[model samples]
Target chain A: MMEELFIALWVIMSILAIAMAIHAVLSRDLIKATILMAGVSLIASFLFVLLRAPDVAMAEASIGSALTAIILVLAIRNTKRFEEGGGEK
Target chain B: MMERYDIHRSIPAILLALLVAATIFYAFVEVGFGEAKVDEEGSVSNRFISNSTQETGSSNFVTAVVVNYRGFDTLGEVTVLFLASAGMGAIVSALPAGDKRKRPIPPSLILTAGTRLVLPLIILFGSYVFVHGHLSPGGGFQGGVIIASGLLLYLVIFPEWKAPHKALALSESLAGLSFAGIGIIGLAVGGIFLDNVISGLGEAGMLVSAGLIPLIYIAIGIKVGAEMTGLVARMKGGDA
Candidate 1:
């Protein structure tokens, strides 16, 4: 039962991570993209925990999601909010 | 609101992505996930796993490997981090400072009060993490980042507030010096840089058990915390 649950959680998180990554790339709004990227990192951290590497998970959560997101958002704040190339918003 | 993608561009991209995913899926199936790839006997990782506690006196094998067996690598990593922050600081300072204008609206009272209330607890927790690094999941990097996050919160809450630039730099320098100093001492005593030369490795799982590891981690934690907070301050357009 525990093994099944672990696999289920892993599958769900993996899918979520992929979906978030796709959305993050596709999103025209830079801030929204940054947030989606952070979500992907958060999901990846959860996947790390499921894999039983708590150390990697903690680092991923803190550095990948928290600090990286903040830095990206700050970068976005300093630059343009919307992507200027072809796609219609 | 839906943004439409050009079919010509997206179709091939989608197909390529699917192909890559399929390849990855097939590879994972062939090479089983969560299974050890290396031989169980005489492997370096296997040796570390089996003998880390006995060798390094750190109950957490990860900590043992990171702060003991591969401590020089960690020192290099910390140096890289320091260089990164220093480079960022130089770049930001070199940039032309624009007209200094105050924030249009002041920070909310609730947020300011909340930040003040939570900041100490965050620092305490970060300290706890690094202090117990040899026995727990967390270590210097994570704890330092956590501490920086707390400082970041304070900076965000108070736009007009200035960080004590001199004090932060002092602490960071001192921490870095101590880390290198400890390694030099180890070299003199044990004939190896960053060796566990603290004579006695106390009972395993205890706070003081990991001899030189905890000390190195503490130095790393302080150095990292200062560096990251300084980075945040620079990014936030404050004096570092």
Candidate 2:
């Protein structure tokens, strides 16, 4: 029963992860893309927690999602938000 | 609103990502789950589980493995982090010198007040995490980043907030050096690097039981916190 539940969880998490990856790639604004990646990180962290790796889960939640997003957003502070070669809205 | 994306340019990247993901999926399916199979009965997992508490005096097997069995790898990881922080510092320092950008306006009163209320509690929680790493779910890297996140929030709210550069640097250096010093002590006493020597492996499951594990964790916590804070401050352009 628990194994079946875990399988369901895995499917849900993977679908969310894939959707986020697609959204990240399609997002126009750089900051929005970074946020999408952070969402992906959050999902990954959740998956880690489900796998019983609390240590990796915490690290991923804090460092991978939060700080990495902050750094990426900061790096593009002086740059244009939208992509240079026009492709998406 | 939907953005009409030109998928052609992103095709290679997408394909690469899919390839990686598929490879990972295949590997996992091939390797199978440890909990599901329990293949290595009398080998690594059993030894780590059964003897970790007795030998390393750490109830947390993860902590025991990280600080005791794989100690040198952790040191190398720390060194990599230090280099990353230093690189970040150097890059920020090279950004035109002097405060080129003016401080932005302060956040609203409610936001500031809320931040002030929560900041101390956040720090306390982070400290608890690393300090109790040997017995709990969190450890140095996790706790340190949490502390840094609190500081980051504080910085974002108060734009005029100046990071204590000298103090941060000094503490970062001290913590890193102490980690090495402890390793040296272990080498001297136990004949192996980062051995749980010098300090007695006290009663297991207790706060102060894991000998040098807690000390090492504390040092890692401080170093990681300081490094993370410095990086965030630099990225914020507070020190620029």
Candidate 3:
């Protein structure tokens, strides 16, 4: 029973990760892209937990999602929010 | 001259991405997966799983492996992490010092108060995590990052709040030194670097039973927490 749940969660998270990865890459607004990337990292962390590696999960959630998002947001703060010269003036 | 919606120009890039993804997927399969069992005798993982507690006296097998069996590797890893943070500080410090950020409007009073209230709990939890490394799901690295996340929260909420630079560096260096010192002590007493024989293995499943594992973890926790906090400050472009 638990195995089924794990498999389901893995499938759902994998799909969400792929979709979010595409969405982040396609995003014109850098801040929004950063948030989307965090969402992807968060999902990856959850997947790690489900794989029975709680240590990896905690590391990814804190370092990959939280710290990385902060860095990306700070970098975006120093630059234009939108992609330049992409019909965005 | 890349256009906003250049469909024709993007086709090759799309195909290249698909090809790269396919290559990665093929590599994953070629490497094999799920074939090794934790209890299968003669396997390296099996030995780690079965004998870790007895050898390291840490209930958490992963902590045993990280702090006891693989102490040198973790030390090198932490040193590399320190170098990265130091490099970050150097690069950012070279940039002209000024408040270049256009921060969002100051948070509302209720939100500010709530964050202040919750911060201590987060810090305490991080402490508990590292301190309980031998008997729980957390250890120094996870707990340290969690603590750094708390500091990150504080930085976002209150940009003016700053930890003293000298204090941070001092604690980090002290922790690193103590960690190496412990290993040297082990070498002197047990004829092996990072040996757990520096202290007696008191009892299994007890907080005090892990010999040198908990001490090493505590050192790692302090060093990691200090380093990560400094890294956050550097990335935030604070005066380092």
**Best lDDT goes to which candidate?**
2
lDDT of 1 by residue, B1-240 (tens): 476644554466678878998998888888676888557678898899888998888999999989899999999999999999999999988877644453447777887898899999999998998898999998999899889888887877787778777888999999999999999999999999998987366899888887899998999999999998888788767453
A17-76 in candidate 3: lDDT tens per residue? 989877676666689889989999999999888777888888898888998899888777
Ranking of predictions according to lDDT: 2, 1, 3
> Which residue runs of candidate 3 sit more than 4 Å off their true CA positions?
B1-20, B30-36, B98-103
With candidate 1 superimposed using the best TM-score fit, by how many Å does residue B204's alpha carbon deviate from the native?
A: 0.2
Model 1 chain A: ten consecutive residues of lowest lDDT = A80-89
TM-score per candidate, chains pooled: 0.91, 0.93, 0.91
In model 1, pairs of residues that clash are: none
What's model 1's lDDT at B160? Answer: 76
| Worst 10 contiguous positions by lDDT, candidate 1 chain B | B96-105
TM-score of chain A of each: 0.92, 0.89, 0.90
Q: By DockQ, is 2 or 3 better?
A: 2
> Which consecutive 10 residues in model 2 chain B have the weakest lDDT in total?
B97-106
Greater lDDT among 1 and 3 belongs to: 1
